[model samples]
Target: MTPNPPAVPRARLPLRAADLRGLSRLGVDAVVGVTDVVEAMHHTIASVPGIVGPAPAGRPSGITGFVYRTVRATTRTVGRGLDALWAAVPFDTTASTPEREAFVAALNGVWGDHLADTGNPLAITVSLRVGGRPYREALATPTGRLLVLVHGLAMNDLQWTRRGHDHGQALARDLGFSPVYLHYNSGRHVSQNGRAFAELLDELVAGWPVPVEELVILGHSLGGLVARSACHLGAARPWMKALSRLVFLGTPHHGAPLERGGRLVDAALGLSPYAAPLARLGKARSAGITDLRFGNLQDADWQHRDRHSQTRDDRAPTPLPAGVATYLVAATKAGRPIGLHGATAGDGLVPLASALGEHRSPALALKVPASHRLVVASANHWDLLDRPEVYRKLRSWLR
Candidate 1:
């Protein structure tokens, strides 16, 4: 009888030793966070009976405090042990799989600020790349025309390739433009990423293999906000001189309602003493996520204020960069216009008016020319990345 064929091993995610260490640390943090919440709840409930004025604030006293403290201490000790064990394991410095890159990007988007603050290995450092590798190695035939593609929140450079179609690659092939991708931690504040990006671009232009004739930026969703921030901060830098065009696809220029809704939920949870402790969970979201509430692109916009507090749109007016051909692309789920509904109809996450840079306050409007705007009907947010019509428009404008 013929021997049975060897079973194929199930494919696993390409997790590294460093990932294990980072995840262990995050696990410890989670446990400590849960203990703090539980202790706060316990203290609040215990002090509720026959109390005057406001509920007692801060951690519980005596035995309760000791128990909570012990839990945290034990968790940290275990985390340190795990870190040492993982660090001892020899890790192969091979290229990361696309799945692993996506996972890291998403993790960075959710808790990137905390990860950076804690020096976690999972936190992605900002870089410019080509074909999942550093840009310098892939630019053997660098061209004068350059296209820089920046991805949206919770995304990495590899994500630009959708359904076998990448806008950057297509532009490179058709327009003789060399495409470079910007990969960054989307969980950090937009202003922070923007400043870093500006510095990177300054270095890139200064050290370009060829004289950069044109520098075009194609930004998607939150990527557009970062690009705008970079443009503003890098106005006096050398890279700005070569920047000729900027295109935004499905960008929330004003603000996204979802983030604002999240803030409202935070406010609602903060109203009751019993539920106040739970507010910490909402507030735990990264600084980058909070910046989306009003599309904050400058440090002054968020420096002193409590990000969780519900406030008016007090963002400083930032007009589009001057002397550059700027294009705005907005998408809507609805196939056609529908009167008053058209004002708010968007690509599920961003409103039409916001994407079009139409704000109630005149000072905040982007002021893009009418010819520079395009609206794609019956398209969702992600469709802006690869729809044939969108590609056609991009080619026509860039050409």
Candidate 2:
């Protein structure tokens, strides 16, 4: 066999792998955290002398005024939207009358939180009217296996639009396999969104256009964990019986060691002047972790679902269910340390071993050659879901 070549070099984030865990568990879902966004924005402005200092001639007086006006306009718009939403809440907790009762009844009728688009990074699924499209909202139907690809944090479904020449739609065209892209809030707790995700799957599977012969779930980073959890939760349903294969791409199966970095940031931020909006991030069993762990929802073991969630603290990854045939595609290149936190090994987001779990350990994990590469020409965590190597493997696996 050809010897493995030297690893590619890239700029490294100071954050350790162990410390950079699923931030959604800390509650930073979809993409980057708010504070980090603010910080990045702040740094961007600070670095630009023109942005931080006085405006150019014929422009607003100073940078502060510019910032204020810009911020004010944006905030005003958002504030009005929030006000309308709150006004629509239909409830008066202080009142004790028929109107309150009616409001409660109406509120109870409203089961789920509004799926508002707040520039949420988790909104990866492309919204298309279902009538004439190949796919919508991860909907799958049987003519053959329907593969739904879910991406991780800071990513969108467009990642899987295609690999090289082969894309999600192409897979459906050539291989007789159906492909759907999944997108959600990566910043939310894994289990919390996973639970809702399960519900969504239940709906999709139940309404599948044809008898779903099989389901192939492919997820990267946090999406992998969520996918597994979803499968477990759907086990009892008749629709779940159609699930045949599972694939995890750079998922932090046992939590990323780097998660600790967010925890530390939360700690430091708490002591600093920027404590108000950040207090939620630093707490133990943070919002991010909670989202993955059921979001304060009860974990009844009636079906033995979510059992893997039990040993998350263990160093090694756990095995998947007995019947399911699972596959893992790992990143061996230089980037973030997977599980060791600050130390190096595997990719930054997922440890090679962890990404594979027990069934698809790194030993058999395959690599994608550069000639056929696209966005993931041997890139990092973000590429696994969108690149050709991954999509190629998934298409074949589904077949």
Candidate 3:
């Protein structure tokens, strides 16, 4: 007779064993990466005369190279030892705290692509959650009307509840719709997450306890871009049939200048050989963040291209999904609409024209009816999350 498998131990609050192991491994990687950067800097400085020559390729020679190599090897050895030590233990994750979730979410937003590529335990898996727990377990009685809330970059579903107010909960209370939050890694490419999301939605609708009557998605910041990507990719999928409305809050439909500014910094650093190696540090940002530079939604937009290279907006125009009711909401820090301040009035992150999907090229513009668009003055990007005015607009439109 075959014996039953050993039970995996569960722990409450703080963090999981896997989280610590992943972090330790990341620390080792960070050390190795920094050592490489330092070595490159040293080599460039040594090779360049008067600090103005073309940077040489590859690692340094002799003692310096040996020291850098040794550091990396030793770090990897320690990382392997930690991995084995942790593997010897029988603990598995069962629960997570809000703080832990936030930390992991932010880490994913920054190094999520790396974490995922390395199969790090800290990598966040896309999941449908209710009240910060798995929706399947928490959803006791599923309703026909489903309201899906998607959060922005560097954020988890738990962050949907801010300042003791949650937009999903409010909608649930005001209406009969059941709320489900999408939690995913925000460091991957928008297209990748979008494809995953589209598939997840298909599974959700197929397995829903009741026949789904109405499906609405309310996305904030990068969440809106993800939703758009999903809709574009899943046009032929069954979930698209149930999708009734797509609402975007402060979505950078055209692109965000902040990421463009970051690119400018990269370009500036590349001007000097001494600073060229340091430019790699900025280039290390996640693909998702880079996608915001031009609101890239398809893999073709980034595939086989240097993402860090400064280039004009060449994204294929993706208009609002056909036959779906769409709404747009934008925020502005300025007090009024017309003036010098109004010329650049944005939510401190995304510009008004971008958020409103207004583009110089007609093909790129997302044509939403004027009635479906709202611009909230004196409100910043985050204010769109739970602002009273914004909530009212959402309730009215959703109702």
Candidate 4:
């Protein structure tokens, strides 16, 4: 008989006596608040261009597009490794010690420091505004339902309001739902931060200054998975009972072909150490490269772990406590070409067929559209996160 896999430690679940010393000695158990992740992203983006060397020291600005993006991606891989180390003790010393507190405080400061540099969340109310208007006004009026908007990998909340795409705030203003933003490492495993997300949700909901009638989540691409993980893990806790709705836009319900993409990239880059590092960055898994890199979360055999373990398909439709409604939005536009080379499904990162939650049995499915991945014009993985269309549909559904 296949022996049950030795139990892995989850932050919220009870820890074994043997592991308690390890866990507590561990400061915070890699509790990746979206705030921490957003801060990390700020540091990364702010430093990337310089680290990549915009012109390679006096060279003409003719840095080829391919070379620039490649170097930029390489810098991202390095930054991600640093983020991973910051997630946990990294060293063998147990977290129970006071040293753990210092480490925890340092990691916590990562976001805090970045927020300070950027002024702050409140500063966003002013510094983050565009066209002399604030985003919170859309739905943050005295009597508005709180709606949280989450972004996907490689982007931030400001991206949501850039130029022609002010979806989150617009929804808040139009539907009378207050918009809250979620920031996290989308490239990381969906489950690594699941428990933390649950706790964050509890903190967000339980700590609401004013009573919020509803708590709705709109997650794009990887954000959807984060939202899903939060729902499942938080259900095991006390506060999520108030969460009312969830909306997924182009999220990879099943693991995206990204793993498949990773394999191809790995093979294409074999032998060169650069290829090895790229494989680590591009490898697709639930916990993400953050685990493999910083050695924070437990690692599964990237090449062969069970797909089910990587994703949360085991969830029962009725599993979510009654009261919350679930909705899905998918993109069919492929990054590949059309006619002779046009792709059939997905918006690059996620397959169109897979993005729709066909497998979620008896969950609160939507009546808004028919089954297949409808072509979302000019859509791609990143676009799903910031797409105006997505926010429009998401706001309507979340409302």
Best by TM-score: 1
Per-residue lDDT of 325 in model 2: 72
Q: How does model 4 score by TM-score?
A: 0.51
Question: What's the distance in Å from true for residue 31, model 4?
Answer: 29
**What C-alpha lDDT values do all the predictions have?**
0.89, 0.48, 0.88, 0.48
List candidate 1 stretches off by more than 4 Å: 1-12, 49-55
- Model 2 score (lDDT): 0.48
Better of 2 and 3 by TM-score: 3
When sorted by TM-score, best at the front, the candidate numbers are 1, 3, 2, 4
Compose the digit string of candidate 1's lDDT tens values, residues 1-399. Answer: 999999999755788889988898888888999888899889999888333234467788899889889999998998899899989989859778998899989999889999999999889999999988999987768999989999999999999999999999999899988999999999999999999999999988888899999999999999999999999889899999999999999999988999999999987877777887898898889888888888898888888899879488899887788899999999888877344565577899988888989888999988888789898888888999999988999999999
Q: lDDT value for candidate 3? A: 0.88
As a TM-score, model 2 comes out at: 0.53
- For model 1 the TM-score comes to 0.95
Q: Estimate each model's TM-score.
A: 0.95, 0.53, 0.94, 0.51
List the candidate 3 regions with Cα displacement exceeding 4 Å: 1-13, 49-53, 92-94, 337-340
Q: Candidate 1: worst 10 consecutive residues by lDDT?
A: 49-58
